[model samples]
Target: MTITIVGVGLLGGSFALAVREKYPKATFVGVDASPVHGQLALAKGIVDQMKPLDEAVAVSTLVVLATPVNTILDLLPRVLDHLPEGATVTDLGSTKGLICQLADAHPKRAQFVAVHPMAGTENSGPGAAFRELLPGKNLIICDREKSRPDSLKLVEALFSDIGMKLFYMNPQEHDLHLAYVSHLSHISSFALGLTVLEKEKDEQAIFDMASTGFSSTVRLAKSSPQMWAPIFDQNRTNVSQALGDYIEFLKQFKVLIDEQNLKDSSEFMARANQIRRVLEGIDRK
Candidate 1:
């Protein structure tokens, strides 16, 4: 089978590598807006060839959209419009609700499946592709009932072959949950990085005194703003709600700190420590 991947950047490139590793005989074609990325993906052997978007989609049995959320929203219907009968299309956008809604009325909607693979690093480009990127990570499929049985089965088998654990949810639920688990963390990291940079004008001091905790907490700040800005825009209402809750917690912690209430602070930390169990469960999985 030929699988065409659009965007051919970090997520798309990594997915190509993973698919090749698992399905050696499958032909992989890449489509990227950036000529540099297309060449790089070809050089890295992430794809067999790089073709124009419509040409790639026309010939492939499956097409994967791995672009930013806004781009996916724009491209999905067009892809469905051009796809041959019996071909399937799936997406790897971060936010699902808007994308799903936009495609709902299309005549070829059943040929499209809305998916978000719960995995990635704060990196971009074909150079960042790796075979192990999606292994053991959660893959969420939204509004599965809306997709045709054959189309859904093909997507399920494809992701399963790549070693992702599949989960199902409506698009609304998916967006709401991701606001807390994924989007909020990125916002917190970006805010923390900005706060430190503003307060510590001495870059050398920040470099010298940075601990492991600081490094890990600020890592997401390095993610591409070009990619994340659209995500935050599309999911603004949910993200705003999550940020408000996070800010309230921060304010409460500050109040306790100002009072020098050692007992209450200790209790707060103890409660937070319960996250260790949740993390351990993830690790075991």
Candidate 2:
């Protein structure tokens, strides 16, 4: 099979590596906006060749759009335009609502599947990619009924082959839940990083005094702003609501601290500890 991956960065390159492992005979063609990334993808053997979007899509049996959410919105329709009769297209964008909505209006809507692989790290670029990234990860496929049976099955099988668990959701539910569980964490990390950086002023002092807890908490702040900014924009409403809820708790906690209410602060932390059970359950799965 001929697969064309656009973007060819971490997610795209990692996915290509996993696919090649499962289907050793399958060929890969890369289409990336960055010349450096394209070259790195080639050197890493993530793809068999590099091609322009039009040329890549023309020869592809499957096209994986691993670009940013905003870029996916622009590319999906154009890919479908060039897709072969039996070809299937899928995206690995973080947000699904806007991308899925855009696909719904396309004439070849059935040819596309809107997927968000619940995986990735703060890293970017093709050099950071590895075949192991997708294994044991959950993948969400939104608006599944809108896709052609062949297209959906092909996508599901490919993900399954790479050891990913699949789940289904409407676009709205996916975005809403992700806002709290995923997006909000990044927002918090970014905010925490910024707060510390602004207050500390000395980078050397931060590194010298940093604990593992602080490093872990602020890690997402290292994530690419270019990729995350578009996601925040695409899912602004849900993200905004999530942020408001988070801020309310922060305010309540601040009040407890200000009043020196040890009992209330302890109770608040105890209540938050319930999240440990939820996280443990996921770990067991």
Candidate 3:
């Protein structure tokens, strides 16, 4: 099988590496709108060759889109037009509802699959990718029933072959869940970055005092603004709703502490401890 990976960034580069490792006979080609990424991907052997977008689609059996969400939306119609009848198309965007809706009535709609692989690092670019990233993580396949059965199975088999777990979700459900888990974390990290950078006017203070907890919480701050800013924009309503609830929860805790309500505070701490235990259990698994 020949696979053409468009975008050639972390996700696309990683997918190309995984496919190369699992299917030695497969030919992998990469395409990126950024000339720098295309050169880097080729030099790093992330793909067998590099090609223009239309050329990649013309020859490959599978076309995986790993671009930013907004860019993915812009490319959907043009990409759908260029795809071969039996070729499969999948995208690795964070939000799906909009992209899924965009591709719905296209003549090649059945050939496209919307995938959100639940894995990534706080890094971007071909150099940041590794083959081990996808293994043991879940890949969310949205609106599977709308996809051609064979195309869907092929996607599942490909992910499974690379040691990934497959799960199905509706686009709305995926967006809602990601808004809480993935999107919220990014916002928290961005806000935390601004807060600390403002407070520790001396960069040295932040460098000296940064501990594991601070590092963990603010790690997403290092992510590309190009990729994340649009995600927050696209999912604004839900992300805002989640952020509002989170702020209210923080305010409630502040009130409890300020009033010195020891009994309620203890109960609140205990409830939060349960989340710590749950996190520990997830880590163990």
Candidate 4:
């Protein structure tokens, strides 16, 4: 099959590598706004060739929109308009509700699949791509019922080939769940990083004294603002609600600390420790 990937950054480039592993003979054509990224992807052999969006979509058996959520919103309908009759289209955007709503009334809505692969690192660019990124990861397919059977089957096969397990949810539920699980973590990391930078000021001291805990906690803060800003904008309401709840918990913790309630703090920590079981289950998978 001939596959075209738009936005040949980390997600797109990694996906190309994964697909190439499973379907070694499939031809890959990459499309990106950045000429530098396109050239790098070609040099690294991430894609067989690069082409204009319209030209690439015209010949592709499957088109993967691996761009940011806002870019996906703008590109989905245009791709559907130019896609061949039997071709399929899918996206790897983090937010789903807005994109799904935008395509709800399209004439060829059924030709597209809404997917969010629940895996990535705090890195971007073609150089960061790797085949192992998707293995054992969960892939969420939103509003699967809206997609044509053939389109859904094609997407399912593609995820299966890349060693991912699938979960199905309506767009609304997917967005709400991700607000708490994914978006909130990035917000927390960014806030923590900012707090330390603003207060500590001593860059050398921070670098010298930082431990693994600090590094891991602030890791998501290093993610690209260009990509995440659009996600926060698109899922503003849900993410706001998640942030509000998190702030309330922080307030409660502060009250506990102020009161010197050691027993209460221990109980609260014990409750949070229950997350270990949930994390263990994921590890086993």
| lDDT by residue for model 1 (114-204), tens | 9999988999989888888998899999989989889999999989998999999999999999999999999999999999999999999
lDDT of 3 by residue, 1-285 (tens): 889998888899988888789899999988888889888998888998889899989997898999999999988788889988788999999999889999996878999999998889999999998888887888999999999998998899999999888889899999998999889989889999999999889999899989999999999999999999888888888899999988988899999999999999899889878888768865864
lDDT of each: 0.93, 0.95, 0.89, 0.94
Q: Against the hidden reference, what TM-scores do the models get? A: 0.98, 0.99, 0.96, 0.98
Identify the superior model by lDDT, candidate 2 or candidate 3: 2
Q: Candidate 3, residue 60: CA error in Å?
A: 1.3
Where model 1 places Cα greater than 4 Å from the true spot, the runs are none
Clashing pairs in 2: none
> What ordering of candidates by lDDT runs from best to worst?
2, 4, 1, 3
lDDT-wise, the better of 2 and 4 is 2
**Predicted structure 4, TM vs. truth:** 0.98
Give model 4's clash tally.
0
Ten-residue stretch with the least lDDT total in model 1? 127-136
231: Cα error in model 2, Å: 0.3
What local lDDT score does residue 259 receive in model 1, on the 0 to 100 scale? 100
| Deviation from truth (RMSD, Å), model 3 | 1.3
Stretches off by above 4 angstroms in model 3 are none
- Residue 42 CA error for candidate 1 (Å)? 0.3
